[model samples]
Target: MILKTSKEILREITLCDHCLGRQFGKISISTNERRGKVIRNLLNCLNPELSTNFNKQKPCFLCDNIFERAEDIVKNISPDFEFFTFHAGTKIPEEIMKKEEMLKEKYGLQYQESIKQELNRELGKDIGAIIGKEFKREKEDVTILLHPYDSKVEYVINPLFIYGRYNKLVRGIPQTKWFCTRCKGRGCAKCGNTGKMYDVSVEELISELFLKETKGADSSFHGAGREDIDVLMLGNGRPFVLEIKSPKIRDIDLQKLELEVNQINEGKVRISGLCFVEKEIVEKIKNTHMRKTYLAEIDVCLTEEEKRKIEEFFLDRDIYQETPNRVVHRRADKTRIRKVYKVLTSKENCSSLEIYCDGGLYIKELISGDEGRTNPSIAELLGKNIKCVLLNVISIEEKV
Candidate 1:
């Protein structure tokens, strides 16, 4: 009785083999098309009257024979990609879905999968067989979008992240590239028509080398903190990340690349501890609250007694530093409280001091007192004039 009723239902409606088979998809570990054939064969054995009509009728009341176009789409996509893994997805029309749901409810097929899911799986199987590649649901290199109008292939290139520490060996070099003041990167005689204030920068040196190695289009530089153009970075160097955009090649020899960069920029800039990283490292490094150590050589018009007192004054004290006049044009005029952990003075050559403070503390202002803008500064403590002639970032603590 069940077999006779199924045959009557098949004869009544216009269902393609795929959709008809999907009505019984959960019966066995077989394809919907195969199940449809099996069901039709069973119906024929049970009922001889409707055998000829069952073999002749061919239509799908739900999809309207859309599955027949899967072959054409597969052929069009076979030569479109050269990727290790891919996934095929479909965007079915609302009307087709409504018809499918209507049929599912009418036939009480609550356990069967949707038409779109089956189509995507079937298409992926066919394409995978031809291309000899596995299907990746997540982190795919390429995705094939199948629509009623056309099929489109999109390559999903993952961004490459590299984390390391860099040393700006020489002075008068900015962390990132600076455009020329005269032409503003448009090129002018005042800047030697190079459109740059400096011939090279830390970003340029590291980014160019990375771009070459990865065959990437471009890159973005993220540093834990920035140092002035005249400040040299020393010690274990400063942490940074290089985000490569649209890299064609991902597997790279980081150690060899690091060696090449250090060799090329021998005395200018150098990077160490090069390693492949994920995107999350960039944000974590940027928002770090690591302590900083700076070595500043200053010229103070103070006696030995005053210098001694000034060095001991900044130890374990809080400074209310307002925005310095020099950077007031760009930075907001506001006050910020910073902590000074230690201040060590050295009178060997030109009166230098190693100042350790919380991150984001303006060391230059601390020495100059920014004309009394910064309270309890070295100048304020000594009650005399002081100027930071040369500054060097000695070390930065790791926070990420």
Candidate 2:
């Protein structure tokens, strides 16, 4: 059956050793090139009528003899970036793929391997050996795409993710870059030709130094949660991930960079516990809702009886909040149920209170009630008109 099939396939079309062996790939543990050679030798001995066809020196009808120049194709590729692991892919010509498919369908070849799979494996091996890098299927630092027909090579450099905690010591800056609403990032008089609403953000203050060191194309800032412009992030700080895209250098000293960033930003913004992380950490940081501790200074002075009532009333209580009037225009007008873990009164200041609650609860609305938008608020409980003069995030509990 094998000899009969080979005789018929060879008579119809010319296939190189690699292409011929790939058709019966599942039948043996050996390579397709070796299998092709063995089958051809057997046919030459058993059938002399097809012997002249073997020495015709014709290009493969399937691959056009691209496999013969595998070494030359991979040797020409030189990646300038630093990477430890790489993955390879090929963009085979559509005409070649169609021809191979037609042959498989006509012969009813069930044990065939795709041209793409063989090219990826064979080219990946040669690329790894030539460049002195390991070939990886998952989490590769870089990807090399080989265009066999065009003799062109393309490289995709994966983004580098860095995890750390940041303290926004000073207020009046957004967590991320806010483009000018009128111009939308294009320079105009509205943004003083800077194309931004604010002069600097927590993202710019931190990511600028990283982009400079790594020589990355661009960056993205992913914080656990963002604080308002006026609110200060104190104590242990907030967790964030900085994604640097197409980085030319990855082996950066995080400890050294952290120190330099803190010194440059000074009292305005500071980062700590800087370390390298995978891309998965970004999603984890964004998805996990953490409990936060806050210190809010209110306008109304709380009496002794009122202070005691406020603390007891908020313990383990659920607060229903619609999107506050201030942010309803930008955010969806939906109600969110959040839990208040604990509430405490300040020892020296009668107008100050410390609130411990879930991450997304609006502390300002909790104090003022946002004109009845938030239920069971401090103002509603005390039956007075209260306003939060200032708010500060003291700490955030890390996820277990």
Candidate 3:
């Protein structure tokens, strides 16, 4: 005889349980695993867990008998992934779930279990019990995406990024990624078919070693402003953050990592403050170039008589500057009035004077006077044609 409606039986059974007792939830099977068999044998067993112990019932139409294999699913999915926490995901067959829903609408499955709720409870407990990892209802490191069709599981892995500052003692490297002017990273005769304009850069030199060590797929370099290839990065070296993608190894020794990166450059580029920073650090590093301190090694064609006067004038003052023609091609041509908050002048000799000023002051144009484009330039102030012999970034400061 066809069993009573699922609604009627489920109301009597309460919720699903172990054994053949609850196969009434699954229409595909005619009997519960053990409950049906034992209840059939007893013919008198009555448990509140179920309305009345049944000798026979239907199988789970939604989950097949796999609900019986919840233990197996947990065991197989647990491995090295065990130590880390995880969240359970149910991959119930759409067709199966729909069939149950249809039967419920037509016949009304009042107390019948839902495939989702059943899977969540049964699998969550079993998986958590096996690996000592809990099925977190909140944040989860591991998400077990289940596929019912192929019985496949996909685990999503998170990425880790490390940040640091590196000083390129070498003068030939660009600060960030530079594509081949000839072929743009694509092989071509103009670029010797290598597609790279430069053989290497500060980013590559630093990240290459890290990529190799961590076995990550790729790396990205972020910095505030870049100096010309010919200029030297002195003082503390330009601040930078190197982001490593998909790194399998996260527990790296910062001090040793710093040593490793420095060793690769062989003193040409030295990296320090090797610490783990988040993606937000990259944005901060670029936007926080508000104040840059520079030391200008100026070469002067001044007589000994005029040197002291130049020193005194530079000792304290608010110098105004505008965009220099040299950088007009790359930077926007706009007049910016940056304050010379502090100035420390050193008389290298009668021929040259070293000037140190607060950050954001363009020292190069301050020397040449930007063709009289800058006011109160050292050249304009001294009323003599003077030039900066060399320029160096002495230090950079920001509240970390």
Candidate 4:
């Protein structure tokens, strides 16, 4: 059957050893080129009259003898960036693919492999050996794509993700860069030519250092949840992931970088528990909801009885809140239901209270009532005007 198939195929169109063997790639463990050579020799011996057609004097109809120039194709790839693992891909011309498909259909070849697949494997093996990098199919640090016919090569460098917790020690700074509403990040007189609403942010403080250390092109910050500009993230801090794009260096010492960042940002922002993480952790950090404890200092002083009543009122209580007026312009004006688990009064200050609540509860609105947007608030319950003068997130429960 093999000799008969080879005789008919060679009579129809010329093929190189590599292309000929790929038609029956799944048949044996030998390389396709070797298989093609053996099949051609056997066919020539059996039928001496067809030996002239089996000559390799012409380009292959399927691949145009691409396998013959595999070494030259790999020579065009020279990656400047560092990568430990990589995968190879090829962009074959449409005509070549169609021709290969037509031959497979005409012969009913079930064990055939596509030209792209064979090219990718051959190129990957050669490139990996030449560069001293492992060839990986899944989660490779980089991918090399070759447009073999066009003589073009492209590189895709995957982003690196780092997970850690951060503390916003000082207030009056946004979690991320806040662009000027008037100029929309373009420099203008209203923004004093800075193009931003604030001079610095937690994201800039943390990401700038990592980008410099890794020699990355750009970066993005993903926090589990953010706090208001006037609020401080104290205690253990909040969970976050920093994604660095096109990092030339991946084997970074997280401990050394963490120490450097904390020292530079000192009183402004600090990060801890810095470690390498996969990209999937960013989604989990954003989606998972954990309980948070906040300490709020109110403007009005409350008596012992008033404090006791306030604590008793908020125990496992569900509070309905419309988006606060301050942030309604940027956010959707929708109502959210959150639960307050417990409330405790501070011994040092009669006006201060510590509230333990769900992740999304609006603490400031819960205190001031947001002009009836938040139901059963401290201001409404006590029949007195109240305002949260100072707020601090004391703790955030870690993901289980």
Best by TM-score: 2
Candidate 1: TM-score?
0.76
Residues 329-383, model 2: lDDT tens digits? 9899999999998999977879988999999999999999999999989999999
Candidate 1 or 3, higher TM-score? 1
TM-score of each: 0.76, 0.97, 0.67, 0.93
Over 1-400, each residue of candidate 1 has an lDDT whose tens digit, in order, gives 3354467567678667687778767766788888777777787776677752344345567766777777776776643323566677877889888887876677677556688888888777888887777788876655667674356544555567899999999998899888998899999999999999999889999889889877787898999989999999998899999998877777789999999999999999989998878688998888876799999888854566765786677788999999998989978999999899988876664487889998888999998889889987887777778899899989999656
Model 3 misplaced regions, further than 4 Å: 1-69, 75-144, 302-337, 350-389
From the highest lDDT down, the ranking of the candidates is 2, 4, 1, 3
Q: In terms of TM-score, how similar is model 2 to the real structure?
A: 0.97
Give stretches of model 2 more than 4 Å off: none
Cα deviation at 370, candidate 4, in Å, is: 1.6
Q: Where does candidate 2 clash, by residue pair?
A: none
The sequence of per-residue lDDT tens digits that candidate 3 reaches over residues 7-103 is 2444443223342244344544333445445444343344345444432255543455676566666666633422255677777777867866765
Local distance difference test, each candidate:
0.80, 0.91, 0.63, 0.91
Candidate 1, overall lDDT?
0.80
- Among residues 3 or more apart in sequence or in different chains, the pairs in candidate 4 whose N, CA or C atoms overlap within 3 Å are none
Better of 3 and 4 by TM-score: 4
